[model samples]
Structure formats: C-alpha cells, structure tokens
Target chain A: MRIALLGGTGDVGEGLALRWGYHSSHDVVVGSRDPDDAHAAADEYEATLDAHGRDAKFTGFENAMAADRADVVVLAVPPYHVADTVEAVADRLDAGDIIVTPAAGLTRDDEGFHYHPPSAGSVTALVADAAPDGVPVVGAFHSLAAGRLADLDADLDVDTLLLADDESAKDTVAGLTEDIDGLRALDAGGLANAAEVESLTPLLINVAQRNDDLWDLGVRFQ
Target chain B: MRIALLGGTGDVGEGLALRWGYHSSHDVVVGSRDPDDAHAAADEYEATLDAHGRDAKFTGFENAMAADRADVVVLAVPPYHVADTVEAVADRLDAGDIIVTPAAGLTRDDEGFHYHPPSAGSVTALVADAAPDGVPVVGAFHSLAAGRLADLDADLDVDTLLLADDESAKDTVAGLTEDIDGLRALDAGGLANAAEVESLTPLLINVAQRNDDLWDLGVRFQ
Candidate 1:
C-alpha cells in the first residue's frame, strides 16, 4: 500500500516512516510543510535503515504532494494543528483516499491532567470537518507513545482502540493497524465513543506517574 | 512510607500494589469500595510476593479506611468517578495525607479520540476542588499502561510526568514514582501543565489505533 506520513518531520511521523519502511513492503513517504525538512528526514531515515541492513525506498515532499500520491494519509501533527494541517492538504486528498487523525486536546490543573476537547467535540472531528468533501476521515492512533514508536528495535505488544463512522474506512485502517507484529486492533464501536478511549491516555499517564515500576507504559487488553 | 491503592481491584491499582509490595519496605495496602475485594486482592498479591520470597507487608480495607491509615492515597478510579471518589473519602483524609488522581475526561467523535475536560478544566483540578481543605492533592501517573504495569516481569524504562501546585506534594509523588527500578520522574511544570500532560493520552491512543505495529503504546521524552 502507498502510505504518507504527513508532518513526517515529527517524532511520531519519523517513527512511523521508519517502521513502515523497515518492517513492511508498503511505500513510505515523508511529508512536511517544508519540503527541505521532509527530504532531510527521509535521508536520515533511509540511512538508519541502511545501517540496519534494510534497503527501503523512502521519498519526501510537501504535505499536499505526499497526500496526493498515497492511498492512506496520516495526520501526525499535534492536537492544536490537526485542523490546519488537514485544511492545508484537503485539496490534495481524493475520493477513495483515507485520512486518519490521532490528536487529543487536553488541559491541566493543580491536581493533574485531563482531556480538553475542542468546541467541535474532539480533535478528530475537527480534522474531519476540515477535510474536503468525499474524503474518508477516520479517527485512530490516539494512544501511542512517540518515544516507544521511534525505537525501531523495540518489540511491541499492544492494543489500539479504533473509532469511526465509516465502516469501510475504519476497516481499511484496521487492516493497516493489525499488520504490524504484536499490535492488536479493536473496534471500539464508533466515533461517538472516541472521548472515552482518548480519555484513557491521561489516566494511563497518571498511573505511570504515581507508580514506581511503570514508565513509557503501553496498554494491552487482556 | 505507607501507600494505599484505593481501587486496588483495577489494573493500575493492582500493578502499583504489587510493585511496591514486592520491591520496597513501604507498607502496601489494598483499598476498594468493597473491603472484601480489597482483602481478596491483597491476599493474591501477598501470595505472589511470598512465592518470590519477598517479605513485604500488605493489607486491605475500604477506601476511606485505607486513606485514613496511609500517608499516601492513590485514587485509582475511572475518570467519571474521580471527584466523587475523592469526596467519598475526604473526611478520612488528614492534612498531611497526599491524594493522587490519574483520571482524564475525554470525548470521541467521527474522526478519533480527544480529551474531554470537566467544566472545571482538568480532572486533576476537580480532584483538588473535591478534596478536603489542607489535604494535599497531587496529580501523578497520568500516562502509564495497565498491562505493562500488572506484569511483574515487564521491563519499564519510561518517564512519568508530574504536576502540582504543592511542591512538597509533587516532590513526594515524584519520589514515590521513581521508587521502582527503570523509571524516571520528570517535572512537567505545575498544575497549569496538567492539561497538556493529560491530553497526551487520547492522542497516544489515537496514534495506536491508526498505525500498524504499535500496541500498549507509551511515551518517553527524548
């Protein structure tokens, strides 16, 4: 499959590109607002894979260009940037293409952290609203740790909750999600249940904060 | 130090209880809404420690009683129950007692998961508001995964973010967080930053959902 990591200069985007390039046969492209940065990241990633004895084809381009050439486009930006990022690439997205978002808005206070949804309900909804008509926007990957993902040597066994209204789009994303070894993809109903799933991140972080033994903690549903 | 897991039947509660009981001299107590459940969980934890030849003292009680007896009380409950849980156990809590909350409110929609804060802003703030006056409320453990924690055999080399208005309480929670092996505690500023920390959960979950090969995902700052 042709996959594009929009905002591919970021920690999560870089991690995704490395993994897809090294672990799968899919074509991986790095996208950034600055094409130069994207190309530079692609070079670094390719070198890292080369050092590890994997010869994978990785390309770089502007965000819109990356989205235009791919079957799947992942918005790997921060929660605050989700809508703007999608809007910037909206024209490049096609009818059959899938767009996925994993951003969650949050707030903090004297005691600890909590989710802060946009007035539109969730960050994912914001992205979907910003996308051009006819494109499928799927909500997913809202609970992954960037550092853990960037570590290509690490073996992961974890579960990801999937939420989307478009069944076909969700299934396509689900198929993509489970393709990686040791990762489990679960259907967490639909987009309406997204808040419940997204909220778990802060809970997990808080648990890791108080406990002594867990750090960079990941969840695996029994 | 005396530690109490107020909802010890849950994954995060059990994990914290087991780790402290097995790895330290701190007195570990299992607390639940139902004292019987606490007793059962305590018994199992004790047996696990005993099999490993660790001489750690563990006990069980209702959450209120547990809070009354411990220097530290972990309100390890779901997001929706945080305030009520703290309120329910408020009277038993003393001035020097430290109360910690790891819950994050989030909402979902057609796109993906996003953080959902209560009307008061962050869940942590709500906890402090609900807590008795003078009883220090510290927000910690907002991002660790339960499956990684419950497994005694897992290797955790991750960082826990801490936020609080009380420096002493934050320091205390930080000390407790790093008591276990392979964990680092980071000062992610004060309560003002709790929203940023807590909001990362749903974003991580969303990333896990959309990506292939990530599960039980965690975060580690570079």
Candidate 2:
C-alpha cells in the first residue's frame, strides 16, 4: 500500500513516516505545503531508515500531489489544521481511498492539558465533514506519544484505537497499523466514538506530566 | 477512612465494595435506596471476602445515612441516576467530604457503544453540581471493568485516571485508590477533563467487544 503523510514535516508525521518506511513494505510519501521542507523531511527519514540497516526510498511532494497517488492519506497535521489539510487534498482523494486522522484538540491550563474537541465533536468528524464525497475517514494513533513512536529503539507494546464508519476502510487502516512491529490495533467502534478515542491523547499527556517515571506514556489494554 | 458505596447492590458498587473491603484497612459501607437490599449486598460481600480468607467488616445503610458517616462517598450508580443520587445524599455531605463518581454516559447501537455525555459535560460534573457546597467531587475508576474488579482471583495491573478541581481532595482520593492492590492512580487534571476519563469506559467496552482475547480489558499506561 502507498501511504501519504500530509503535514509530513511535523513530529507525528515524521514518526509515522519513519516507522512505516522502516518496518513495512508500504511506499511512504512525505507531504507538506512547502516542497522543500517535505523533501528535507523525506531525506531525514531515509537517513534514519538507513542507520537501522533498511534501504527505503521516500518520495517528497506538495500535499495535493502526494495525496493524489496514495491509497491512504494520513492527516498528520495539528488539530486546528486537520480540516484545511483535508480540504487541500480533497480533489486528489478517490472514492475508495482512506483518510486517517491522528490529530486531537487539546487546551492547556495551570492545572494540566484537557481535551478541546472541535464543534464537529472530534478531529475525525472534522475531517469527515471536510473530505470530498465517498472518501472514508478513520481515527487512529491518537493516544501514541510522538517521542516514543519516533524512537526506533523503543519496543512498542502499545495499542491504537481505530474508529471509522466504513468497515472496509477501517479494516484497511487497521491492517496498515499492525504492520508496524509491536503496535496492536483495536477496533473502537464507529466514527461516533471518535471523541472518546481523541480525548485520550490529552489524558495521557496529563498523566505523563504528573508522574515522574511515566514520560511519553502510551496506553496498552489487557 | 470510611468509604460509602452508593447504589451498592449494583455491579460497580459491588466491585468497589469487594475490592476495598478485601484489599484495604478502610471501612466499607454498602448503601442503597432500600435498606434490606443494602444489608443483603453487604452480607454477600462479606462472605466473598471470607472465602478469600480476609476478615473484613462491612456496614449497610440507607444512602443518606451512608453519606453522613463516610469520609469518601463513591457514587456507583448508573449515569442517569448520578444526579438524583447526589441530590438524595446532598444534605448529608459535610464540608471537606469527598464524592467520587465512576459513572459514564453510554448509548449503544448496531455497531457498538458510544459516549453520551450529560448536558453538564460529564456525569462527574453533574454530581458536582448536585452535591452540597464544599463537598468536593472527584472522578475516578471510570474505566475499570466490573467483572475483573469483582473477581478477587484476578490480579489487576489497571490504572484509574483521577480528575478533580480540589487538590487536597484529589490527593485524598488518589491515596485511597492505591490501597486497592494492583491499581495505580494517575492524576488526569481537573473536573473539566472528566469527559475524557468517562468516555474511555465505552471506548474500552467497544474495543473489548471486537477483540477475542481482550475480555474484561483494563488499561495500563506505559
């Protein structure tokens, strides 16, 4: 499968790019508004893969061009940029193509980080509303720590909750997710439950902040 | 500490009563609308503890009476009943007393369960509004599985997310939570974040429903 990481210069985008590029057979395309930045990030990802003894070719493109050729597009943008990112690539997505959102709305106060969901209820729903017709949106990887995921030395026994309205699209994304070594994918019902999945990101961050030993925490269900 | 389990005949109430009664030195009081039911449930809980070779005393009382004597009151009632349960026990809660809510609003469909938060944003918030002034409300144990908690034989490595505005009260509740063997309590922030903690319940249920080996799943952050 070909996977496009939109906003591919960001932390989450880079994490997904390196993991998928190193661990799986999926062709990874790094996408950004600036073609130069995308190419730079793709070069960095390729170097990391090479250090790990994997020779993987990563393509860099403008967001639209990247989305146009991929079977799956991951909105690795920040929460506020998810809708616009999806809109920018809307014309490129086909009916059967899958869009995955790892973005979560979070607001911080004196106490700790709290979930600040979009008016559409969740980032997944925001992308669902903004995407072109017939393109299915799936919410996954919301609870993962970017620092932990990007560290190839860290053995992940972490689980990612998957949510989507379309079963086939959800299954496709789940399969892609499990291909990353040691990461388990659990179906967390349909799009209506996206808020629950997205909210976990802030909760995990808050927990990590309070505990000394629990830095960059990731959730595992047993 | 004296801990009261409101709606003590219910699944959650029974699980908490059993765990606290068997694992900690705290006094466990079972409360219900009906005194007879409370007494019966308490006796059952005592018998279960006895079979496990733990000699623990359990008290049974009406909801109001239970709240009057306890230092921490746990509202183990369902989401719909949370407000009324708090209201019924409102007059009994003295200043500095703590009220804990484990209820999560859930609505199910053909696909699976989705979070249906109350108009107050979360059941914890609803109880906070209904409780008497100065009675601090803390949200904890929102994501624990009742069956796993009730089974004394099953070892728990579960983490319960705690949320509250009152720092001292939050600390008090956190200390109480760690008394239950194998349960670690993580401070998840203030009551504004309760929806995130509550919503995790249904998300866990949905994930457990879809996965075969994930029966009675519980979360551990690593």
Highest lDDT, which number? 2
Docking class of 1: incorrect
Off by more than 4 A, model 2:
none
Which pairs of residues have clashing backbones in candidate 2? none
The TM-score leader among the candidates is: 2
lDDT scores of the candidates, listed in order: 0.78, 0.91
Tens digits of per-residue lDDT for model 1, A97-156: 999887777776554566667888777777778888888778777667666767778876
TM-score of each: 0.62, 0.95
Please state the error at residue A208 of candidate 2 in Å. Answer: 1.6
Top candidate when judged by DockQ against the true structure: 2
- Measured as a fraction from 0 to 1, the native contacts recovered by model 2 come to 0.78
CA displacement after TM-score superposition, residue A11 of candidate 2 (Å)? 0.6
The C-alpha stretches of model 1 lying farther than 4 A from their native spots are: A1-94, A98-118, A138-222, B9-11, B33-41, B78-81, B105-117, B195-219
Q: Tell me how far the alpha carbon of residue A162 in candidate 2 is from the true structure, in angstroms, after superposition.
A: 1.0
After best superposition, candidate 1 residue A183: deviation in angstroms?
14
